[model samples]
Target: MTAQLANVAAVHADEPSMPGIVPATLARIKVELLGFIRNPQSLVFTVSLPLLLMLIFGSVFSGPVEGTDVDFRQVFISGIIAAGAMSTAFSGLTISVVIEREHGIIRRMASSPMPKSAYFIGKVLMVLITTVLEVALLLLVAVLLFQLDLPATAALWGTFIWVLLLGTAACTMAGFAYCALIPNAKSAAAVTTPPFMILQFISGVFYPFHMLPGWMQTIASVFPLAPMTRGFRHVFLPDTFKAVEAGGVWNLQGIVVTLVAWIILGTFLTAITFKWRGPRVR
Candidate 1:
C-alpha cells in the first residue's frame, strides 16, 4: 500500500497543471455553440422566424415615423432585432435548459468534472452568437431589400453594442432563473410562449407603442422586452421617431438600469433555484 501510494504521489507531482477556467470555459462555449448550430429547429426559431417577421411587417407597413424621412421599415428593423434577441436568449435558452434537464443531460453534466460556470458561460456565448447572427441578417435585409440606412457613426454603433450587451445579459439570466419553474419539457412552451407572444404586441414588436392603451403601455414598460426594444429603437431610429414612443423618447439610462437590475436579481435566483436534475419520479 505504501509503495502504491508513493508511486501515485510521484505521478501526481510530475503531471502538468490543468488549464485555467477562462480557457476551458471558452472551449466549452464553442462546443455548446456548435451544438446549437447543429440543431435545425434552434436555427429556425432564433434566426429564420425573426427575419420572416421583419419581412412581413416591413412589407405591410409604410410611411415615415410620424414626421421623419426615415422609413417605417427602419423602425421594424430595430423591433425585429429586439424580438430575435429575446426569442433566442429568453425563450430559446429557457426551453433548451428545461429539455436538457428532462433528458438527464444536466444530471450527467453535474456529475462530470466540468465547472458549473462553464455551463452558463456556454449558454451566454450561444445567446450572443445567435443574437448577433439575427441582427446581422436583419440589417442585411434592411439594406439590400428596403434600402434602409445602416448606422454610420461610431457613436451609433457603440450604442448598438451597449444595448445588445445589456439586453442579452438580462434575458439570458432571466431565462436561466425562469427555467426552474418549469415542471417538464412537455410544458416548456406552455410556460414560455404566453409572455413572449403577449409581449410582442404590448412591447411594440408588431405595433406602435402609442397605439396601445395607457394602462397597457404602463404594463409593458415594466418588462425587460419593452425597454430593450425601445432602447434599440433609440439607437437605430432617427430622433423624430421618438414622437411615437410612449414617453416621447426612449429612456436610455432607465433601460440600462432596469436590465442591469434584472441581471443581478436573475443571477441570484438562478443560483439558488436551478435544478441539475429532473424531479424525482414518484
Candidate 2:
C-alpha cells in the first residue's frame, strides 16, 4: 500500500495552482471557507464539539482540580478548547488535502499560474477564520455553560491569543506532516482520526492531566497537544491549574519550549515527506 501510494505521488509530480486571479490568497480563502461552512459535519465537530465538551465536563466534574481549589472546569476549559482547535487544524486539513489530491484539485492547482505561496497562504487564511470562529463559539459556551471566565488582564488575553495562534500553527504543521506520510486520500481519516480521538483522551481533555496515572502524565506532557492545553489553561484561569504541570509562574517557559519544538519537528518532517499526488491517479 505504501509503495503503491509513493509511486502514484511520484507520477503526479505537479500540483497545479489557480491563475489569473485578483489577490489569489484572499480569493482562495473565500472559496475554501465557503466549502467548509457548507459542510454540516464540519460545523458540528469543529464548531460544536468544544461547546459540547465544555457543557458536559463542566456539569460532570462539579468542582476544582484534584490537588487544588482551582475549578477543574476552568482549567479543562482550555483543554477542550485546545482539543477543538487541534482537531480542526490537524484532522480537518489533513483530510482536506487528501481529498483535494484524490479529486485532482491539487493537480489542477499546480497546472495553474498561481504561486505556491499564495495557495498555501490561502489555506492558512481559511484556517485562521475557522479557528477564530470556533474559539469565539467555544468561549461563549465556556462562559455561559461552564462559567469559565475570560482572562481579565490585558496581558493574559494577549498571551492567550498568541498561544492559540502558535498552537494552531503547530497543529497545522502536524497535519501537513501526516499528509506527507500517508499514502491514500481515502485512508486519511482511517489514519488520522483514531489517534486524534485517543490523544484527546490521554492528553487530559477528558480528564485532568495529573489525575491520570504518573506514566500516562509523563507521556501526555511530551506530546504537543498536552502542552498546548496546559498553556491555554494558564491563559484562561488562575495559575493554580497550570501547576498541574509546573509549580509556579504562568509557565511561559514551558509552553514556548514545547510548542516551538513540535512546530519545528513537524515542519521539517512535512517538507521532507509531503507528496502532491497519488501514483495510481484513480
Candidate 3:
C-alpha cells in the first residue's frame, strides 16, 4: 500500500499543473490567432472576399432599392456583414476543425493535460474576435466608400450588438456541430462550402430578401443567416423598409428566437457528435 501511494504521488508530481481556465483559454486563443494570421488563405476568404463583394455589389447596385428610398448598396452592405460573420464563424471553423482532426491534432490534444472545455472556449472566443474584426472592416468600408449610413439611435445600436453576438454564437456552435458531416480533411470544403454558398444566395446576402422566390424565402426563414441579415438591415436601413420583409414586419422577437434556437440546437448537436479522433480512427 505504501509503495502504491509513493508511485501515485510521483505520477502526480510529474504531471504538469493545470492552469486556470482563463489563462489556458488565453493561451489557446493566442495559438489559434497566430495560426489564423499565418494562413493567408484564411485571411483572404474570411476578410478579403467580403470586402471585395461589398465593393463590387455596392458599385454595381448604385440606385435606390425599388419601391423604397434606401440605396441598394445600403441593403447589400447589411447582408454582407452577416455573410462575413457566417464565413468566419461557420465556414472557417468547420474547415479548420476538420483539418485539425484529420491531422491528428485533435487526438493529440485530447490526450494532453489541457482542459477540453478551455480549448473549445478558446476556439469560440477566437472566432468571435475574428468575426467582430471582419464585420468592423466591412462596416468601415461601407461607411467610407459606399457612404452607408450609421444607426441613428442608441436603441438601433443595441439591436446591432445583440444580433451580432447571438448570430455569431449560433454560427460558431453550428460549425462545431457540423464537423460530424465531414469524413476527412480532403472533403471538408466539399461538404461545407455548398451549404454556406447556398445560404448566402438564398438568405439575401447577394440579393434583397423580399424579392426572393416564395420557396427560397421559406427556406431562408428556417436558417440562421436570413434572420441575421434581416437583423442587420434593421440597424442600418430605415424602419419603413421593414414593411417589405416577410410578414411585412421586422419581427425583432422572431429574429432573437430563431438565433437562440439555433444556438441551442447547435450546442446539443456538438455535445453529442464532436469526436476527438479522426473519423476513420478506431
User: Which is the leading candidate under TM-score?
Assistant: 3
**Each candidate's clash count:** 0, 10, 0
Candidate lDDT values, in order = 0.84, 0.79, 0.91
Per-residue CA lDDT of candidate 3, range 1-282, in tens? 999999999999998887788888899999999999999998898889989999998887778787788888999999999999999999999999999998888888777778888878989999999998998888899989988899999999999999999999999999999999899999998999999999999998888888889999999988899999999999999989988888878999999999999999999999999989896654
TM-scores for every candidate against the unseen true structure: 0.90, 0.86, 0.95
Residue-wise C-alpha lDDT for candidate 2, range 1-282, written one tens digit per residue: 999999899877765434544487777898899889899886787678777778777888867577888876777778888998887889888888888877778777766677666666777677878988898888887787767778989988888887888888888888878887677777888998897888888887888776788788678777678877877877777765556564545568777788888789988997788666665554
Per-residue CA lDDT of candidate 1, range 27-88, in tens?
A: 87887788888999877877798889888888888887654666677777877788888999
The reply for model 1, stretches above 4 Å from the true place, is 1-19, 65-70, 280-282
Tell me the RMSD of model 3 versus the true structure: 1.6
Name the candidate, 2 or 3, with the larger TM-score value: 3
The deviation in Å at residue 280 for candidate 3 is 5.6
Lowest summed lDDT across 10 adjacent residues in model 3 is found at: 273-282
TM-score of candidate 1 on Cα atoms, chains taken together:
0.90
Clashing pairs in 2: 8-278, 8-279, 9-278, 9-279, 15-110, 16-109, 16-110, 16-111, 17-109, 17-110
* Order of models, best lDDT first: 3, 1, 2
Candidate 2: where are CA atoms >4 Å away?
Answer: 1-22, 247-249
